[model samples]
Target: MTAKLEKTLGAVSLWGIAVGLVISGEYFGWSYGWGISGTLGFLVTTIIVAAMYTCFIFSFTELTTAIPHAGGPFAYSRRAFGEKGGLIAGLATLIEFVFAPPAIAMAIGAYLNVQYPDLDPKIAAVGAYIVFMTLNILGVKLAAMFELCVTILAVIELLVFMGVVAPGFAISNFVANGWAGSNEFSFGTLSAIFAAIPFAIWFFLAIEGAAMAAEEAKDPQRTIPKAYIAGILTLVVLALGVMIFAGGAGDWSKLSGINDPLPQAMKMVVGHNSNWLHMLVWIGLFGLIASFHGIILGYSRQFFALSRAGYLPKSLSTLSRFKTPHRAILAGGVIGIIAIFSDGVVNLQGMSLTAAMITIAVFGAIVMYIMSMLSLFKLRRSEPNLNRTYRAPFYPIVPGIALVLAVLCLIAMVWFNQVITLIFLAMMFVGYVYFSMTKHQRENAEEDLMLVGDNH
Candidate 1:
């Protein structure tokens, strides 16, 4: 069975899905970097990361346009490197798309708690999963429509948040003990930058998720490229705007290391118990929900793609009456829910489960980035005559830069997020082992079902 993702997403809807998948990163996650490197230092790292994402997105567009498959990187790497490479790419996509929701769910819970302070965050998170997963199962069209609605509202919310915090934005407040919190750079400061890299990357982590929906997109060749490019630029600008304003609003450290970073920044201007603060917190839920919902859509398609190709149980590839990947959606939701309560994240040693999950998700993203870029180069050389509607502009240079930055990002994560990275590697190893043992089973697949893209 092939992935039956409804091709209801046009370029605008695709933009919404792409930006929606990552807007929460703007609203949360990145603030954790402030605790690591302070404002000035994180700003430096964010600039470098924005540059990397710009390059990566541009290079990745070619793959999405040329292949136009729901499997995204799995399709790219599978065609280029066969089963072993396909497993690595597909598993990493799973980690990136699957693990991210729990983190976003935690942020959703945190945002609700900021507003009410009585509702348990975990309860709210589970409720979010229930609500969004139901919507996802109902239909892909409805899900994409909802994605467009919330994504627009979330963008407006961020702009309004920046407006509310703008008057408090001061250069002096921003630089106060900003450089590694010591007012000077040291070896420790350099270490902090490395630690801060993942959070910096969080600003645009899942924007590439739009590519995962290529099979469900209208005119995938044209719409996918436009959506990916538009989505990345939008994220880069908004990330900078929110980070700069939020950091300058007041004692930025007060907002550091928190899941509800936007609300914390709002409280600096409006007071802790201000009505505006409460409203801001309420509005923040849309950002979190947009990502939570959008990524659920992403991971399901990926799961469908893998299962359809025999990397997973083919049963998961079956579509529901509504034609959405219902079983796959539910499977991913179950995994994320379990992750919320999972204290047994082995190799994190003593790391907080939330931190470990986020780090693992980022690790997955880095791996896909490297593997996908390599797939791009390999395809260019190996399949020179393959059909192509678009080619990466800078060829070797753009992808070359994205590749080097991806490796650097991986090294940074390994150096700083040791236990979490270890946990991620352990998961990958287990997946490879399972794939190894199932090698005979994989070989029995029909040649027709082995083809990439949604055409099967």
Candidate 2:
């Protein structure tokens, strides 16, 4: 049976869905990666990542425009490769969603602890998880509305980040740290670019998130692509601004080991004694919380979509009278709690899981994109008159380039992060086996029903 969709999200609302909570992670991840890979010149490293992010989003936008389904990756896989394919995609996507909340909640707790010092970070993290859970369970519309508030706060914080750091601009910090071991021209410089790619790709994720709410979006065909393009462009600009301001505010050398870079940059530039630094830090903290919420919103919708497709448990598929997938939301929250506890025990066992999950999430997305591009090509040849409000520009060329870039990124992730990539693929393999068995049983049951119908 086709699932009923509630029109709780519109074009602007869908845009708000992505803008809210991802900024914190995006900024933090990019800064951390750049700081770690200190060998590459900041500009070269930044450009490499920007290219990956741009191509990844371009691929996702093509698929989203074609399907515009709530399932996102899972739905795309099913459409491309059928039930078993959907199950594998669903599992990979689930890993990302389930692990994200606790990671973010822990981050919230960590940021709070920076200020309070005395606040039990664990309890604070759990508290943040509970609050976010309550918001999600309340329903998607309410979640979207809450997300709107967070998005506004995040944008203001970003503006504050730019305003505070732009003044302290210094070009030397960037140039001083020339390409790692570079004697004019060498592979070491090339290595730096390759090394920085994954972290860069991580920053620009969730660009396709707007598509998860496509069914609910007002004129989804138009809205999803517009939001997709707008959200990605905004984040791209934000990322470049952060890179410039951070590199300028202080030597990248000193920024290491600090969790709140924007505030730290402000304090270094304007003096911690000033009220402005304090205010920006407070705002930065809120932006982090908002980003967490936005991710949860996008991830849960994918879960809901997968469950409804019968690849996940039927219970998770059931929507409430309010038209929200309460069970799936709760399931995701439970996973978050598990992640939080796991993080507490180890340096970041759960956090590692979150990272691994993202790697696999992109892997799955790339695979789906290749298939979706093929589907687009197939449709063009077979179903020429399909009602598509938006066709990918340059036809096969844009989509073709997108597909090639996605494959390249996937290869790089697998090559560099092999162990984690293997674990993720193993998880997907297990899901595939389980799904195949389930399908066999389901077909048998259907046959029995047909026999009974004939006897009657």
Candidate 3:
């Protein structure tokens, strides 16, 4: 018998997981947008991306509620377009979920290194993988409870950050060189805005990851819509608030390149020695930990779901005594840990490892988003009679907007980051090769089962 995941998540827990999966964005990664597009330009990129997410989530909820599958996008695509489409969506999602954690984990290490300057960030990153993977392996309920606690603290800390920095915020500082490559909008500024797409995406990248938890959610059809809608609203408010406040607090350019922009921005307002700065560092960790821990859970579930369906080795589908996919959890951790160590050695398009990883993850996410929206549209026509507790408001228009924005983001990313785009394509090619090789085996197994049934 297949070992199944326990349903212990309520709307609140699902919301926590949704928000927590991407909260690290508020703390870091996104400042890189400021680097490429400046404040105003990146703001435009963010607004576009935010709109995409808002629409995507609303439409995505329909599929999540209807299917209530752990495979998330993979399951949706499989039902809509069959095994090949499932392979594409599953691989894209796996890449997104697996690659995102290392980038977040590295940021976690960077946050810790602020307090203990002597400690190596990579070691701390590996430690995080070990700790969170263990927590997830123990049980989903325990992992989600911890995620909720940290997510709440992280949200509060971000509010405090905005409050404390509000007084120091200056319109002049924020708008200074607000457009990348020029003070005024031009062709260059347009290029910069497009270049900033991935970082802008960083703000709300994994919000759709909530769908992965549908199989484990209590009254998922009802609870998931609530959790998803609320989660996106919360993230948009926080992302806008944090970015605007952080930019205006000081010379936004100075904060653009670093991983721990929140703490650095706070120091400009509160002074390096102030208690508020210290609190931001310690409390700020909750935000990073929340994302790091939550994404671990998300990726492991994807692994388990894929493996259980024979997309991966079946060993990964085996649940621990605690009713968790321990092997899957460990498998993703091993990948993330390997990525953490590959930091300086592997550079894509002259970008730092963290930036490259973020870009790669965004690449996966965009592909998955495109596939998911297509799946949504296909199912709407193909299975019109399918029960949907929550239909996407505005139908074609809503999902159409999401599909357009996702394709645009992909175009911008591929345009600006050619090398990383190739790398991403290479990864997909490899996954496809594996899938093709395994397809005949799966078909044979099915035929054998049919034969046995005939004899019986």
Choose 1 or 2, whichever is better by lDDT: 1
In candidate 1, how many Å is residue 323 off? 0.5
Model 1 quality (TM-score): 0.96
Clashes, model 2: 3
**Cα lDDT tens digits for candidate 3, 261-309:** 9999998998999999989999999999999899888888899888877
For model 2 the TM-score comes to 0.87
Off by over 4 Å in 1: 1-3, 343-351, 446-456
Q: List per-prediction Cα lDDT, in the order shown.
A: 0.86, 0.63, 0.90
- For lDDT, candidate 2 versus 3, the one ahead is 3
lDDT of 1: 0.86
Q: Assess the local accuracy of residue 68 in candidate 3 as a C-alpha lDDT between 0 and 100.
A: 87
lDDT minimum window of 10 residues, candidate 3: 447-456
Separate clash counts for every candidate = 0, 3, 0
On a 0 to 100 scale, what is the lDDT of residue 352 in model 1?
55
List, residue by residue over 97-203, the lDDT tens digit for candidate 1. 99999989988988888767899888888889999999999998889999989999999999999999888789888889888897888888888877889888888
Compute each candidate's TM-score over C-alphas: 0.96, 0.87, 0.97
Give the true-structure RMSD of model 2: 4.8
